[model samples]
Target: MNNRLRTTLALLSLAALAGCRGDREDAPPREFFPDLDTQLKWTPQGRSEMFEDGRTMRQPPAGAVPFGRRAGVSDAAWASPWASERDRFLRDDPAYFDGTSGRDAAGNPVFIEKLPASVSVDKALLLRGQERFNIYCSVCHGYLGDGKGTVGVQYSPVAADLNSPAFLVADAPQTKDGYIFNIIRHGKPKPDGSGGFTMPPYGHAMSEADSWAIVAYVRALQAARSAATPTTGGSR
Candidate 1:
């Protein structure tokens, strides 16, 4: 063959060989599907990191001490300074909060005490008032209208002496049933007292009928406090 024809044939042969190269990218990767020899021999354990003669090794021996051991876990305890406890949490609370049903046996809402001289109520209402007062008020305000309740002794600012006439004096319009109703609905907040703690507002806790009934009973309590105890100071 002439030199040019022979060169052309050689170039054509090279292109055919190039196309047959299964190792090229478009050919499915040999690494993707391993041959029998590679599959049997290649394994994760086949490769390993070697420690050269003078190189510092990273892995510690099985029983070797950890260098610069991590700091020990702390065992210190902590508690909040302002934690508050409930009355039930401590048995010392005398009242101990026996709850009221807020209703009489007849299903009518009732007060925590008795009716005043100005107003008369049925026996059912009076009985219900007595029960409510026994549940709520008698703990701080005495059952006898003396403000000397079993739980009152524990108070930081001593309980008011309800037996004294002056206690009612400041409650001007004290005679007014409406004023009593106001006090019951929106508890009297004491501004000057040792405790700004007022009686809890019954506005949300009790119905209007119940609030008025409580006012009526409280007036009775007030009247009881005003009751005279005749003192015949030895016939001097």
Candidate 2:
């Protein structure tokens, strides 16, 4: 055979042998690049010799403001320096945090009488409120906000009827928007005093804005039902 033909046959035989790699159980495969084997990175807490400080983690520069901090924000939004617990509480407005309307001259705790100015009653807010209410609240309060939800029916006492005039009044009102907001933020208190949760607190689950949205959606339901039904004297 010619030298070229002999060389070609040898090369073809080697190529055929390479193709049989990893075909048998005893034949372990090997990677020329081994990309995956070398791709692992050091964890945050892991030590490294790359820096003089010997830290894989990076430290923020001095006086660097945290993400999303607005310049000249309200004092209530900012934390006071070296403030005590009582002092911090005093700094926070009761209407905003605890959802209270302060006190009456008789030394009784007065619940909120109106909705906060911060809550806008526009279409967008109402829609968002409705969406949140249906997802988190409708199972307990019903889509109509009539406290006839399936879960509530299983309980000894049904959920609070948001359509009730005592809570959601039309021409005249008694309960404040803050009262409803408070209820949504911190669930209803259980009578047993077991210290176990009654209605699960959504305050930890949802944002303050989302809780207010639910309140708005509830008011929307009330307004819709009241509009549909005819009223006789002061009774519905």
Best by TM-score: 2
TM-score list, all predictions: 0.39, 0.53
Instruction: For residues 129-223, write the lDDT of model 1, one tens digit per residue.
Output: 66666666678777865668888656656555555665456434444455456555666677787655555556676655565556556666777
What local distance difference test score does each model get?
A: 0.53, 0.70
Q: How accurate is candidate 2 locally (lDDT)?
A: 0.70
| Model 2 deviation from native, Cα RMSD in Å | 15.9
Model 1: lDDT equals 0.53
lDDT string for model 2 (90-125, tens) is 545566555567877997656666555656778898
Candidate 2 collision pairs: none
